[model samples]
Target: MAMPEYTDGVLELYEITNDESEDYPEERLKYTGLRIWYRELAVYDTTRAKLSADSVEVTYKLAIPQYKKINSKCICLIDGEQHEIYNIAHTTTKDGFKESELTLKTPAYEREVIDDTERTE
Candidate 1:
């Protein structure tokens, strides 16, 4: 089957790398400019709140090539916003096209504040 061509929008996939240095222990997500075509499946309000605030659930339909690799550890950058990929299901469309349904959750660290207060003895 041939891969379907999508003209909706481009999405960037990022790989999360854990950096554990003495200075900082953080997860670094890097994007290698791997752009692909993806369409928005649905965006609705969720009953659960994220970070003690309201949130929404988003789903995307990605037309990825059969040889491409996508996993749960990957994050999707859409419209300058990072979304965590929770579930990925590969399926063949009725038109003989390979597609992947990505169920994304809101970013975990949306509005993180850094506290750099120093303690004086």
Candidate 2:
């Protein structure tokens, strides 16, 4: 099968800053605006503690002049929201095309909002 057309979605990749001092140990993620051809699928569920969580699965196709490496330390920004990348699964390459399935976690604030909306409806 041919690769899916990714003209509709853009993948935003981020890098984690590791500038931490003895007194201040804080790491921040910087958005590089490096977009790629991709598609996202999300699933929302509640935990046993009644906490809401979202698992955002992204299918990203490899592009030329690769921007940044996709790893657990990276974050994906979709639709103006940030999702923490937890796992990256590489699929078998075909026709010189490579793709990866990224498992991302939704931010807490976004999850809360989704939970609230689900409750109201």
Candidate 3:
């Protein structure tokens, strides 16, 4: 079932901030708190020099909207799989980070279609 979109609902969705602020104070340099979905979370292994990690700790970049609760977990999708994330570590950059960076493995998929062209030869 799909929930109706809030037309008048005053619920503030979460979002992550990445743009650099010059006039804005450092403390107010937009931080990603909510509005982040899990599947959108990009996953990678933190390693010294290897590609994989024995234990994985995921990281997410999300946008936080002003006037919303800061303690809500967003549903994450990993390679078409769904996941729930309650706590997400926050990071900021000159250009905001995307939520697609917290998966155990990278996402990849493909589709196959049969050719329907008739051969004249």
Candidate 4:
């Protein structure tokens, strides 16, 4: 029983990969340009209420290709909102697809550092 309502939303999948830049070699997170199915697990305000400051929680269902690499650092964007991916467990697999249970939430925003090095002696 496929629900059309749940498939209405689009999920932008992003993956973490190593950037081999000569000067700024680091892990780079970029979108794989893959669109997957996205749906909220719970629509009630209870989930949003329990969220931490500036954090929005949502669960999405998606089937990823086996060739694509996915890690904890992967990012998911839905409805112009970005989310941090947690432990991705496969719910099902068939036809070279991995159905992952991707529950995401907004990561805690880091506050700007206050430079207090100048001491008034």
Candidate 5:
């Protein structure tokens, strides 16, 4: 099964789709309060970053118009490895019901066990 592509870039929590089917449609515009998974940032790189799935805390608008259900744990593929986020949070925009950006603080690479058989010299 092909997985939907989700980037770690700044995301705007829109809304969740009210579908009665089992398969979640990617075309749905509704923003589900779900943690988006993405690649971890390098530990040494000290620079401004956007709100990604790895973000520990997500800052949204001050006035939360609605809330969507999200996965407590999510997997993000970086460099081909899967990384998981523990928790996710959302806030209301200070101005109004606008797109809020969430940021994550995580190590560039999430430690993973490599298979020796896959190694090549």
Candidate 6:
């Protein structure tokens, strides 16, 4: 879908990245919080997810390096909880901005992170 003319850009992303080093398995995962603009999407049933079957669209300025870094395997922290980015829909706006509609593997509700120290990856 095409992005709107303007976005308030209030949402945020955890932007997880793996180190890909076999030697340091413990420290192989990394996380980067990314500011984003998102709107709620319809929730549905999906047997694929171990968590809640919910998703959200993460629209934002299409950026490279970081944009190139994201894929189906990538996961991000939403409110400090882990959520998988199952799909990515990229769009170029009329005024020249990049947008990403990121679908997740879990419910977008109750995303509140209880403890930051509980993160394993």
TM-score for every candidate vs. truth?
A: 0.66, 0.58, 0.23, 0.51, 0.27, 0.43
Q: What is the lDDT of residue 16 in candidate 6?
A: 34
- Report the lDDT tens digits of candidate 2 across residue range 4-42: 555656666666665565476455666555676665544
C-alpha lDDT values of all predictions: 0.62, 0.52, 0.30, 0.52, 0.32, 0.45
Summarize candidate 3's per-residue lDDT along 5-118 as a digit string, tens digits. Answer: 223212112222333555652211122222332223333333422433533233333333222234323233323343334344444433544222222222122211112132
Model 6 lDDT-worst window of ten:
57-66
How far out, in Å, is residue 30 in model 5? 20
**Better candidate number, 5 or 6, judged by TM-score:** 6
lDDT tens per residue, model 6, 1-121 = 5435323323334433334565653222233444454555444434234233333433211222116556754555545555656667776656666666556655343333322443443
Ranking by lDDT: 1, 2, 4, 6, 5, 3
Q: How close to the true structure is residue 30 of candidate 4, measured as C-alpha lDDT?
A: 62
Model 4 RMSD, rounded to 1 decimal = 11.8
Model 5 lDDT per residue over 14-45, tens place: 22233456575322233233333332233223
In terms of TM-score, which candidate is stronger, 3 or 5?
5
Q: Which is the winner by TM-score between candidate 1 and candidate 3? A: 1
Find the candidate with the highest lDDT and give its number.
1
- Select the stronger candidate by lDDT from 2 and 3: 2
Question: How many clashes does each candidate structure show, in the order listed?
Answer: 0, 0, 26, 0, 15, 2
The true-versus-predicted C-alpha distance at residue 16 of model 6, in Å, is 4.1
Cα lDDT over the full model 3: 0.30
Cα RMSD to native, each candidate? 9.6, 10.3, 20.9, 11.8, 14.9, 8.5
* Residue 94 lDDT (model 2): 62
